[model samples]
Target: MLFDAGTWSLITDVLAAVFILAGAFLTFAAGIGALRFPSLLARMHAVTKPQVLGLILLLIGLSLRVRSWSAVAMLALVVAFQLLTAPVGAHLVSRAGFRTGKVDESELQPNQMEPDDDEHTA
Candidate 1:
């Protein structure tokens, strides 16, 4: 009950194609959302979330196709840097937007980041 080498190779190829297509689609969608979204936070969400996932998917597909440990190590480093940086970058952008009043206060739910009048007076 085992696939032959050729069959296994074909299966991996198909799966790799699927992942690559999905990753491409998500990356495309992220671009569209970044352009179309009206708000800074929305654009940030679009850019950070889908792009990171898309990148991971793309790297996974590449690894599957390349089937080389060295290539995978490089891809892993890419993903690691992406994972580490994307969130921090998003947070910084969002905070900058909020502080600069680019984000409308009314749209924020909870709005914990809003500065209190007392703090301003002090």
Candidate 2:
């Protein structure tokens, strides 16, 4: 009985710790990417992608440690809201960056953003 209960608790703690550490690592990577990347789009991608996933992982770890339904539910909502907005916010920021002429046009593909000549023709 002691082994079963105590071991299970220990396992849970270890797993939660792993998740937390991994989440921290992901967030750290995101920060590094945001700082190191040259282009606006690249920087935006770096800041958002891993950051969102890291937030999710961090929330998961918090939920596991709490082990409460209410806490988990709140965390789920947080994750949901983050997931819904992160991409959209990133999109807006990138678009703004592009429109502001901060992004290098040379970084884009040859045909990138080229209007469809056929579409405009009668």
Candidate 3:
């Protein structure tokens, strides 16, 4: 046989466990940020960045355990779509939140906000 079933099984399990734990941690952090953040924009930042990454990690880990080229390819496609969309979606949501005055500017650094038009007086 080209492979030892028992050893390979153990290795696969270990890898899966590690991936799951990391994904769980990332998701947990996102949840905490969402709950603890002072504004919608901050919460959006948490979800769009860490949550997306966590999901990608979880999907990749599951694909590795599947050990099939097709599955990995599908997972890669999903990850690619997520990478392309999550940030854009988050940006739209943040802009909506800002326009709606749902965000609290006091929590953010002053420099992060654009200079006021009144401040640009000639």
Please name the candidate that would achieve the greatest TM-score relative to the true structure. Answer: 1
- Rank order by lDDT, top first? 1, 2, 3
Which residue runs of candidate 3 sit more than 4 Å off their true CA positions?
1-5, 106-122
TM-score of every model?
A: 0.87, 0.86, 0.78
The global C-alpha lDDT for each of the candidates, from Candidate 1 onward, is 0.94, 0.92, 0.86
How do the residues 1-122 of candidate 1 rate in per-residue lDDT, one tens digit apiece?
A: 59998999999999999999999999999999999999999999999999999989999999999999999999999999999999999999999999999999888788698898999998
Better of 2 and 3 by TM-score: 2
Give the per-residue lDDT of model 2 (tens digit) for 25-120.
Answer: 999999999999989999999999999999999989888888899999999999999999999999999999999999999888787678888978
- Name the runs in model 1 displaced over 4 angstroms: 111-122
Instruction: Give the C-alpha miss distance for residue 57 in model 2, angstroms.
Output: 0.9
lDDT (10s digit) by residue, model 3, range 50-106: 899898879867986888999999999999999999999999989888889887777
Regions of candidate 2 where Cα sits further than 4 Å from its true position:
1-3, 110-122
Consecutive 10-residue window with the lowest summed lDDT within model 1: 105-114
